[model samples]
Target: MSDHELRKAAHDLDVTVWVGKGGIDPVVDEASDQLKERDLIKVKFLRAARAGTSVEALTEELAERTNATVIETRGNTGVLHR
Candidate 1:
C-alpha cells in the first residue's frame, strides 16, 4: 500500500495493538493474524524492544515473514498492512 493509505489506516485504526518484544518473527505473525481480523494493523512499539533496534531493521525482519506493508511510524507507534 502507499504511504498515504498507510497513514490514513493508522489513524482510522484508533485502537492500538501491542506486538511486544517477540522479535520480528512472532511480531510479524501477530501482525498477519491481526490483518486477518482487521484489514490494517497498528503495531505499537513495546518496552521489550532494545533501544539498539532500528525501524529499518524491524521492517526488513517483517518483510521476510509476511506481506504486510510498512505504513508509518509516529514516535513509538507504527502501522502495517497484509
Candidate 2:
C-alpha cells in the first residue's frame, strides 16, 4: 500500500509492542512475531527509550532489526509493516 494508506490504517491500530529503557533488543522478537501475524503493528517508545535519540531513529532501528518496513513515526509512536 501507499504510505498515506498505510498511515491511515495504522492510525487506528493500538500499540502492540513497547520499547523501554532497554531499547530495541528487548522488543525485536515480539515485533517480529507480531508482524508474522499482522500486516501492520504499532509500537510505542517510552521517554526512557528515547534517551538521546529521536523517535524516527529508534523506529528505523527497530524496523531494521525486525526486518519490517516503517510506515511512519509520529510523536513517540511508530507503525511497522512486513
Candidate 3:
C-alpha cells in the first residue's frame, strides 16, 4: 500500500500501532484473533532503529514470523496484514 492508502486506512479504521520485539508470536496470535473479527493490524517498528536491524529485513522477518502480508511502509512506519 502507498502512504496515501495507509493514511486512509488509519483514518478509516482507527488503527492501533506500537513498538516491541521478540514478542511477535503472542502479538500475532492476539492480532489474528482480532483480524478474524476486524481484518486490519498495523505495528510500528522501533527495535530496528534501536537494535540496528534494517527496516527491510525487520519487515521481512516480522512478516515471515507472523505469516502476515506487508501491506505498506511509509518511512519507518509499517503496515501489516491481519
Candidate 4:
C-alpha cells in the first residue's frame, strides 16, 4: 500500500502492544505474533521505555527485531507491518 493509505489505515488502529520499562526485548515475540495475525499493529512506547531514547529509535529497533517495518511513528506510538 502507499504511505498515505497506510497512514490512514493506522489512524483507526488501537495500540495493540505496549513497551514499558521492560522495553522491546519482551515485546519482540508478542509484536511479531500480532503482526503474523494481522496486517498492521500499533505499539505505544511508554515513558519508562523511552528513557534516554526517542520513539523513532525504539520503534525502529523493535521493527528490526521483530522483522517488521515501521509504517509510522506519531508521538509515542508507532504502526508496524510485515
Candidate 4, overall lDDT?
A: 0.94
Q: How much lDDT does each candidate structure score?
A: 0.65, 0.94, 0.58, 0.94
CA lDDT, candidate 4, residue 35 = 94
Clashing pairs in 1: none
Given candidate 4, what's the lDDT at residue 19?
96
Predicted structure 4, TM vs. truth: 0.97
Query: Which should have the higher lDDT, number 2 or number 3?
Result: 2
**What 10-residue stretch in candidate 3 is worst by lDDT?**
10-19
Which residue window of length 10 is worst by lDDT in model 2? 62-71
Residues 1-82 of candidate 4: C-alpha lDDT, one tens digit per residue = 9878988999999999999999999999999999999989999999999999999999999999988999999999999989
lDDT of 1 at 56: 55
Off by over 4 Å in 1: none
Clash pairs (backbone) in predicted model 4? none
| Residue-level error in angstroms, candidate 4, position 5 | 0.6
Tell me the tens digit of each residue's lDDT in model 2 across 11-81.
99999999999999989999999999999999999999999999999999989998999999999999999
Clash tally, candidates in order:
0, 0, 0, 0
Query: Cα RMSD (Å) per model?
Result: 2.5, 0.7, 3.7, 0.6
Question: Which tens-of-lDDT digit does each residue in 1-82 have in candidate 1?
Answer: 5768667757967644564676565566666677778767766666676357876566545644667666666666666666
